[model samples]
Target chain A: MSESPQLTYAEIDRTILDTLRPPTGGYWLAIMALIMGVLLGVACWVYQIFIGIGAGGQNIPVAWGTYLINFVFWVGIAHSGTLISAILHLMRAGWRNPIARAAETMTVFAVSIAGLFPFIHLGRVWLVYYMLPYPNQRYLWPNFQSPLVFDVVAISTYLIVSSLFWYTGLVPDLAAVRDKATGVRKKIFTILSLGWTGKHEQWRHYTRGYLFFAALATPLVISVHSVVSWDFALSVVPGWHSTIFAPYFVAGAIHSGLAMVLTLLIPLRKIFRYERIVTMKILEAVAKTIIFTGLIVGYAYGVEYFLAWYSHSAVEIEAFRWRALGDYSLEFWIMVVCNSLVPLLFFFKRVRTSIPWLLGISILINIGMWYERFVIIVGSVAHGFMPHAWGLYRPSGIEYGIMLGSFSLFFLFFLLFVKHLPSISMTEMKETLDLGESHGD
Target chain B: MATDISVIGLFPDEQKTAAVIEAMSGYPWLIDRVHSPFPSHKIFDALKLKKSPVGWFTLAGGILGFFTGFSLAIYTALEWKLIIWGKPIIAWIPFVIVGFEFTILFSVLGNVLGLLALGGLPDFKGLKQYDPRCSGGHFGIVATCTEEEQDQVIEFFQNQGGEVTIFE
Candidate 1:
């Protein structure tokens, strides 16, 4: 265990608040770029809403297009937060202390972004409430048999519990913020903190409550992606109809989630001067976990192909054959190289430790995961059982623009979060220092 | 009779704070509260408080959520009488998904509710004696005592080399 340097209470408080100070010009420049992208995305959505679903690239066979791909991508990205926060904490991993706050924040924002696509995909957004099982004048209820309905339930539940977990964890740190803040800032933090006074009576219950939330959230992390995968797996579609999808999707989710966390944290640590707290040792541990998950994803890929051949199902074989050699052949090879081959570099100590290497590999994983969804959703639907109905589907400019906007929105939220809240958990970091001192680290 | 006032002792070291709690365990002064930046097992053992009952709330809520989710799905299916994929109205297998989702939803609600109800949270009015430094890195002990014992309380904190603040 590489120890973090001992930090005093005042020093920890000061270091974290310094990140909240007014941004430099570069910060504003980045924010403006993100805002422009977001605004462009909104304009595209408005135009689509007015001109109808034709503005999107959704055709007969490929009704689920880039919006669906972005949905799964964002949902997949949301997994790492809970994995690092709830799962690692339950397993007694001490290194998660300084990073859990940011990871959980990522989960919240990614899910928010993911939740939007379904509404965007709904052509008549006003009738979107038809998806709910409320007692309505029409007396129609959503079919529980549909994985889409399960998705609604699962994603919404994940959002609520994840938000609760994130906010409850923030209470102590928010109290710290309230103490250091002045005037209007203090009032906002105080209300957000709900009068957390660090009294033992509240701490006793608070600790227990946090533990329960973690336990509750752990299964949620697993169930969410499983339900998402079922959205494809439940169908008789050749490429998607497989038993391996749930665990496969879960592993891939963690793989991409870890990559995204590293992608965000590397620059964040450098920019905010948090090298001491977010040490290279912690980064290495994360990289090591990524290598393991990446291998699982690679194994899943090989098994998927092998199973299709072994079963001697003509339809399945044709789907795999087309995926490797047909219309989307370039995307297929790129995903294989990015997801399966690139991560193997981490096996060497040098690549894992180098910030540039880690950043490059992370961005590759993000792109690869998005293509993974694109290939699974579009590639399968593009060439169906009826070859006569099969046709090519390409994303239009509006599709590309909206996708760009989604990314900008995600980063914009992260920028605001980094600027305002304590990105690292102040209370937990102080405890780590105390624990280090007692153990003579 | 509302004759009780309290004095809080703040210390830079956790061991010193834990020691004060141990020393006052048998005293008449109520040592119902101690403040620290993080949870301390030593102070917890010294105070001899019971395990928090918050988990019970989660358990209760999870059970209710499961039933609520199942009932809703089943009721909708039965009432609507709509069948897809030629399946039966009460498809327990598919309903399991809805049930599982609500289980998490209600359990989280229970957890937050238990936190607020049992921990007495959101009390902006009652925090007169809270020292901000306790959140920074200090440990504090708050003891409610009669006015007559106020001097002894202050003396006790002084004897322990603590920074004392008395709240009326």
Candidate 2:
């Protein structure tokens, strides 16, 4: 809603398309670094595979370690993308037009990265196909009642739906690029654009399809995360088995995701010169939403402890108590401070509007979120019922390498996305221009 | 197939283009297609097109997906006859999550299919008559007419301040 007034339709197309210009030497250097990180992760995984799963610190008690934590963290990071692209579109938030594309791209990449952690966690990654429901000579069928099976269905559906929704939005913009490009680029865009010509007939069905995808995606986003939460909620672990896990996880996911969007977008806005399009108004709006979600997350934390006390169950009480006061208490406190307390700073307009403060808080919140999952997964599993079986879990070097690799892969995909495609929606920007012009008259 | 001989009018402003489209309502069939860089309800209203039936595809896909999800769960459970937690062999409650995900996934696929099919997309021939400016800031109206009416259509577009081109 706060786009620059002087922007013409031509300027919008040109400026957005300009972002796709050839990457400079610095860009390649960053890409090279990310590629190295990715290879290090791969090398670690290969070593783990050859040396056995025990090489990465998964003992009897703390079987689910940093891999699960990273899985939940990355998935949580993906939530805000759908919330922005689909939910905001449904709400008709005009401010979403410029930021939607970036958010959606993040969703695609984050989800892709998130999907990999399960396989990385699966020491025998080659056996992943067995998780799929298929007929075989063994006549073994995946249990439909299992939450793990639900994760497979939910995550696969999410990845597919998010990709479709993202591509559907990109079609017209690809056409705009196609028209501007020539030779190889033109041919590539022509195919990617699916021969879009922006005809009224195409727009008619395209709008309807886009709306339907958004509608479908809105519920899918909620359901996917809910399913992910059930992976723990359905368990008998004292800290994990709670009805509040779904909404609590969903809120925490959005909170972290909003932080990540800020984390990525702030630097992107500066580097890409998208300050006019992704303005202070938009950033402030995101920060405000972060406050609301952060509060919900904070409340969930309190309620979790309250429930532990209210249930009068000794194990549940001990689980909550040990989480805050035990070996991993540092992580627990960091999660609390970052995920809940940090966003409270945004209540003041000054903190909310300050670029440095916003960026710093966003990054801190992401770290807090990662720790939140770590505390829940490892802490709960480590300090479960029966003291003799209890043990603390530390992420071995391989685990850290894989986690770093996932982040590198995520960023590498995003960097490639920025260089190849129009990072902003040129079509929507032009529509805003037309609407603004009409309102002006 | 031979392309239709049409008179194309390119307008710089969307408002003027919508006005020209509205003025051409009397000769509705003469308007082959109106193009713009973005979707304009104004142009859509001027064209007076019927509502898209893409929702039907989505609805059908949802129903199909729901059944497919339930059937897979039920049939596989029945086939295995293995009850771990003493729950029912056909537990409808847990299957709802699977059905819900599939419903959304298939519905999205259907919507995309309907869009491509109904919109006549992947239309390689579309570029033949398309002006690149339409993808930038221009609005284009392609109207087809007989040889006699071509001159009149060109004159009409010119009068409406549109830059006209004839595709023969």
Candidate 3:
């Protein structure tokens, strides 16, 4: 096999910084669309808050509707960053270098979007602080046993740690930007860079700090999603209650997450002409990871069914059967076809290498994962122990608008981020280039 | 600190930079620091620097975070004393999640603080001594030398294929 061509330091510097230049008209169009989405979502949310919880489609039994579905969806989308940045870094996967920054950026924005849902879901959004464990006048504290409480700890910790990890990696690169920039731009980067000089002492300590953070972040990713799964599993709902939920959720999170990385990066690479940095090789590697995660998720799906039958509980059996042939059976099969079947196409090199196929599969997986949550949340709740109390949840326009807005919000933050910061890590890319040249490959 | 005039040398090549660092070790001039576009194991080995101690700070933060997380859970459970079902007030099993999360939170806090303390960041004082080329593709060597030894250091840098400048 032929080795990749060498890139000079100047080439690396110029090409990476090319991303930070003034935005094109296309960029403005994308940003405007995202902004519109956010505004519409915001308007819907305001209407809901003012009018009350009844504006949502949720009713008896199916109390968790599109809001919880969107919440879990965004949270799952946030997983790839830690997976690519921390776990892949620990594993010393070199292809991760080009995509780590974008993935981590996604993690931060996705979590921020996900964080808002808890408040949006709360009919009393102003009283959200009651979840905090504090000594109050009423002697009230959030119950430790509540999975919702675990969510607070897990998600906030994920957000903080991921932000720090992203910022820490930015220091050296920010200094590089500072060196190259002028006027107000220079001042901003200077402050943001925290006076990094890339000195040996600084690099030494910074390396150790980065390693420690990555070490911590790896387990944090698993824990955050596992805790999210417990929000369902800990409940007595037949479909929701299962010991396998943790691993199952973690796998599904990563499955959708890897696809998202592809969805975002494939277009990103083409838009920025980063064909060299985010090479076909890198895309292929990511596609491979997608395949692996897909299988694990598929296995989890299979295991869930097998365990349901093995339990010999009529309710568990009915729950699984209902999911397959129930009212929302269309969504259940859509999820199966999207998540499990479409990903198998990646086994072929042609499919893995094709951008259109990658994008299509990624979009499908995203929908599949979203519907997977829908099936899990709405499917189980709609068919309860008492047939008389069972209910079906059809999402209202307000709920749909808010969900669309969440997507727009996520993209809005990312678009602004892409405009201001270097989308790729400058220092890491240079290091990779230098290593390549050092070996004279 | 003002009395000690500093000399800075810029190297376009990594091999020459390594040689310059090694040469400075034998002279009376105190090698202040080396700046490269990226971290180099070769440079660190040539300088014979000690391993950084930032990990210890992270360990301390992690331990502290664990206790803090436990305290928040256990202490609050004890205070609230709202018995849900027949479960114990201090649910150690479920509380482990809190402690685990806290351990990560504090570890990062500690890591960042440790980085700031050890790296001496947020101070732009060193920006004056910094050569922007060092961040581009060049490697920089900063040495502290007396006026008497300045000529020898400059000649050494020139001989090693480096561009020399005095740090103002």
Candidate 4:
């Protein structure tokens, strides 16, 4: 009687719950860090409110600061999450399930958090709403022709679409949670579950709907970054105005995004005891992506220089020189090493799967990626076509605080998300694992 | 505590309803679909399902999305126009981005409306009747049968099986 042939629904549910609810020792510490990060960030935002965008590193020539760069960097990092999940799903890649939801959530949160920078960068944060072109009595309207306007549209679209993609995947899972949780949680899950009954028909639509979104999302991943590139390309700055900027920016986004995923997940897998879910195989796949995208990104760098030389445009040439040999020359070289050279470590299969090495490479890639944006934004702006407008760009503590705080904000939401949802799609993983068992051995 | 029931079959279309139906023909049981999975185009063949109203919703959404996208684009561009010494009203080419985004935005809205129309969700009542294994890909088909026919179902399933389990 005790040994029934099939698992009772109770047992199946319990097993799933047990797997996700791994005990946490330093849960409080992680929480504390998130709180501190938020406090620092809020303080900085308040300061920006009082002192204006000037409190950060915005001056005559370089109106953009670390906030904008961070915005771009975080958005780039966020891209890989949905892009990875969608690509894998399209390919019917079996490895994607465990990683998809986490990746999707990451995209949603990072993109949303990154969305704040453009607003924060506004001198009158109060008047930032003016960026929106609402038809009202004031009669002022947002410029549709501005690349920044395009950015507003693209970023919002990416955010909304990616979020729907994320939340759609969670409906059935939420129902599962609802069944298990009680009282307030049960009520909350029930509401969020949106009456998902795990019915035959619902599953039918859900799958097809998710797939359609995946197909749509793939090009979007490319477009969002390309749109981001256009933000720079549309500008008259010699360094920024290149045709290759779109694809170059796209590849770099993927490169840096892959690196960030690795950096975040290495610690995440360990802390959550998801070693099995985020297996060595998964790490190897990530390493391969890093290598693949890194090559494209590095080529973009070289191409920037070559184009500068080939076009014989001295203004572009000067900007290129400034990127490599100017005061920020050290950053330029480090970008080369970290983004291009350091990623070479992934060439070795051993190092790719080594957790510590994976973490180091990822951090390097992230830094390199940040510097890459800095080169485009600050480098191009500081040493513009008109050297008369040239100026030094320095970050103030307020800028650093906001940047650090955004990181905290991202993590805080992500951490809570993990605890609440099934971090890995339990059902999807079991289906993959069960594939081998079906051989009737 | 453990008995493995394995089914190896084809998912000819999205929702894999056809796969489930094919399996059902062989075993007389009450089958439950775990959750909706991807590859959508198979609603008719798999479960003999009706077409979704998502298209209608999508159309409505597309219209709404157009207004939202265009209004935002036009208003923003006009607001504090950087009067670049007299550049053309920030060319319409840039407005295309907003248009493209609105199209997709409305499409998702259509999907949500379609979902709500199909079923006002958070189905606590119906959820209790379903199985988690549905999400796991094993459309669990529970056969309520007498002892005599049990072995035959088992044999048929073995020839066409993967991860089969029995209760009682």
Candidate 5:
């Protein structure tokens, strides 16, 4: 019998926009857990504000603790969105369009969450914007060449561009929403969409323009992460001074970013019943990307050991030794197992296809990536060449609280975003299904 | 209706779509309506340029993004001097990265914003025309004409083997 049920675009759009409507069981719990974590994290931040930076971990040598760790972790995690949307777009892979928005959202949220770290760690959130180069009465200015300063510019640029890319792709979809919206949603969509009429000529130029922007964004990801790597490598510190830092960081960023993409998407696909658009095929492809990058990351770790041993530099050798069996040795071991070993599980096709395992691995990888950064930052600096100067880094409650809150903030934004937009490209899906219709004599 | 009108139909095919476009070059008031099972990318060259401002947006956005990026980097580095590796306070070469990232990011954003603005998207008002089928698979064409010249246009469309609809 021919299929009696024909789902229209309206139904799809409604489902996408209505993701948050009085959930039944699982979704409600997830949302609740996210909200609770965020609230608790906020409370922790409050506790930290009263007590100061002492609540967490930060000492003489290891000045950057979990706060900086989270910052680097999240930034690395943000790169895949641009990689997927821009690189895949440039490469003309059709599977990218559906998943790109989700990845890009992850990037923006991760970066935004990461961006707040400096302030959270600063113990002075109000003066954050004072980091901007505003010509003031004091004639104060910042050094233009610091990698951290470069990171500020790079991360901000990445955020703005990525946001615009994701939102711009949403214009037509937003227009459709505006058309169906009855009240405030309609007004919001209308304004956000800017009155898209979907004329043929417009579509023609739109595709061209979108493609152009994607091409532009592809390289930005490479540069942004390299710059982030430079923040450490540019320094004269023993562990941070390796020339391999750029490639190593880039590979690690991609590794973490892929994990983040899977972590966010696997659950979403299951919950929203988006199996058709974000099919198992798409997940499998992404799994392959993860595996490839995982290998790269594992290799990068190997390279680090090789260079340190081969270079015969005392400081490098000492840094490596400390990382493996240092005061914070546990973090280093966790990073190796989580980042290197867990990813190896993906080599089996069965493991890659299993959503539960993917989620587990993704979560573990993120944790591991965070640990990796901590190991790199803290392991090297906390106990330097001078034994007497060795000091432990304990982030104040504020730093730790903000770090936890950052994830909550990201989830909160994502939850709100999913509720307003069509998570899947309805039009694209329809186009895919219409091949038979086109062949009718 | 034009008394000299002619009607012709062709099986929807790319070769036919191309033929119709090629044949239309003969008629002064040439109007050929070609139907396709799907939207054809080739039709664009047949009908191009709708005055889009996305280019300007991208250029401006990229500039803004780069400036802000470099500016932010410089600002932050100069703000305090708690040496990490005992390096100098004014770190310049390292800051080049931040500047580069901002430039790419802002420009890309501008392009997207410009595209949105140019496309006139997010229009809430349900349009009068454009059946949902238009978004589906139908390729529709509306060729306007006077009663006297309708016959010539129809003849040209017919010779090119196109679907011609006549209404008064």
Candidate 6:
């Protein structure tokens, strides 16, 4: 952990509480804009439902397009939340104290948004319940042996567990908010807090419960993305069928996830004036971790090419070659430059510490990660086994609109989260302050 | 029957509150509960509480979840008896993935349920004695006493440099 910020317990409560006071005109305007974007996406989805799945640009050999790409991309974005909150907590990293709430909130919102893509991808959105394992008159149960089924189960579990973990951590802070709030707000928080009194017994069980949830979330986060990868890996498509897909996808997920964290948190810190709590030191540590994940992502790219050649599989070689130098080569190289090259800037201290550089590079990484999924999902399928079936794919305007809506929805939820709840873990910050004071004494 | 009263001692420092609890160890039952803005290992040690059994809840849920997952997959597969692509009727590998997800899902649910049950949460009664300052910087120790011992308890708290409030 970096040097503890000089903050009193009361000050911590006051500052965090101040963030929840009221939404300003600017905040409302941002909300209005996001809602408009969400409506546009919704309208496009409705049009697609009415016109049939043919409304999108997906065609034979490229059956999976932007929807699947968005699904995988958003799922990847959710990974760093668990990494920062659960894994860091287990490691006892104190720097995570300030950012953990936001990351975990991001996880819940991102995963929720990611959950929508599969449904949107299902053109007959109404019959989506067919994926559920229920006995019906038709006597059909979802194929447990299928990777898609695995995704449904894994992602649902991830959402539930992540929600539980996030809510568990929020309880004490909710109680603090309840205490500070009045009238309707107090009643609302009182109910939300479930009447938390922070008694010794409550704390004892609460601590144990939080630890258990974190422990569960660690493996759950890993498995969720692995299952998402299996959706492609289990296929016989040349570029998709790789044993290294799980770890490669996992690394890429965290890489993008950390970038998204910076992208959101940098602006958040500036707006909320959380500079004291979310110190530069913490951001630097995050950047350093990004470098590690980024290298793994870069290494995965090299290994994919190496293995394609090393295996001497003609189809795999063609699939990879077409990815880099074919119709979608621009996206492939962009993914490479943005994900692998952009993050390398963090190796320079000036880049890591500079907010503009960090924000810019992180944004590039987000774009790169999105394209990374696009390359892997669309690029692989577009040029698979049968040379006669080889074709190029491009997203329709509807697809683009829907993707825009998803981004707006994600930011909207995050905005609401910051305004309604304690964005920082007030209880944890107070504990840190108390400990720091004692140490100084 | 003698009416019982509760005397609440609010301390500014958690360490001082913990010390008071330790000094009054001979009358451990007198310390009804200690409330703080954060979890205090110091007070927990002074009180010498037992470890929580929430993990057992997690273990039970995990075992149940594994069986539930495997059974659901196996029964459904056998009921159909339909084979796909020459794959086995009961594929354990894919079923393991389902089982693993369920195990985590149920375990987390169990952990939360246990937390609520063991913590006696959703108890509005506890809030009556709760000082909002406990959520800020103060540490409050609530103790139960007989009418005869109320003065003695207040004096004890006052002697420990605590501000005392008596509730009848």
**Per-residue accuracy of model 4 over B1-168 as CA lDDT, tens digit each:** 222222222221233444555566555543334233222334335555665545566567767887777766666666656667686655567777887778777777776666666555545565554444444333443334456656665555455443355545
Candidates' chain A TM-scores? 0.97, 0.97, 0.98, 0.93, 0.91, 0.97
Sort order, lDDT high to low: 6, 1, 2, 3, 4, 5
Every model's DockQ, to 2 decimals?
0.81, 0.85, 0.81, 0.29, 0.28, 0.84
Across A168-209, the per-residue lDDT of candidate 5 in tens digits comes to: 677666666666667987778767766555555457558768
Superposition error at A335 for model 4 (Å)? 1.0
Candidate 1 per-residue C-alpha lDDT over A1-441 given as tens digits, one digit per residue, 9 for 90 to 100: 446556677877888889988899999999999999999999999989999989998998999999999999999999999999999878867788878999999999999999999999997898998998888888898888789999999999999888889998899989988888899999999999999998888889988898888898999899999999999999999999999999999999999999999999999999999877787778888889989998999999999999999999998999999999999999998888899899999999999889999999999999999999999999999987998989889998999999999999999999999999999988777766766521123
Evaluate residue B84 in candidate 4 and report its C-alpha lDDT on the 0 to 100 scale. 74
Cα deviation of A201, candidate 6, in Å: 0.4
Model 3: which residue pairs collide? none
Candidate 5, residue A346: Cα displacement in angstroms equals 1.8
Candidate 2 lDDT tens digits, A1-441: 444566788778777888998989999999999999999999999999898888888787999998888888988989999999999889877777888898999999999899998998889999998887888888888988899999999999999999998999999999999999999999999999988999999999988888998899998888888899999999999999999999999999899999999999999999888877778888888999999999999999999999999999999999999999989899999999998999999999999989999999999999999999999999998989999989988989989999899999999999999999999898887787645521121
Over the stretch A1-441, how does candidate 3's per-residue lDDT look in tens digits?
124667678877887888899999989999999999999999999999999988999988899999999889999999999999999889877778889999999999999889999898898899998998877898888887789999999999999998989999888888999999999999999999887888888888887788888899999999999999999999999899999999999999999889899989988888888877777778888888888989998888899999999999998998899899989999999999999989999999999889999899999999999999999999998997787887888999999999999999888888888878889887777776655522122
Name the 10 consecutive residues with the lowest summed lDDT in model 5 chain B: B129-138
How many clashes show up per model? 0, 0, 0, 35, 38, 0
What is candidate 6's lDDT per residue for B1-168, written digit by digit as tens? 353788889998978999999988776337888999998888999999889999999998998899989999999898777786897899999999989988998899889989999999898888887788888889999898788888888889999999998776
Number of the top DockQ candidate = 2
Q: Per-residue lDDT of B31-128 in model 1, one digit per residue for the tens?
A: 85899888777778888878999999999999999999999999988878976689677999999999999999998999899999998889897557
After superposing candidate 5, which stretches have Cα over 4 Å from the reference? Answer: A1-29, A394-399, A427-441, B1-42, B45-95, B113-168
* lDDT computed for candidate 5: 0.70
Off by over 4 Å in 3: A1-4, A437-441, B1-3
The candidates' interface RMSDs, in order, read: 1.0, 0.7, 0.9, 4.4, 5.0, 0.8
Q: Estimated TM-score per prediction?
A: 0.97, 0.97, 0.97, 0.83, 0.81, 0.97
Q: Which residue runs of candidate 6 sit more than 4 Å off their true CA positions?
A: A1-5, A435-441, B1-3, B27-29
Specify the CAPRI tier of model 6.
Answer: high
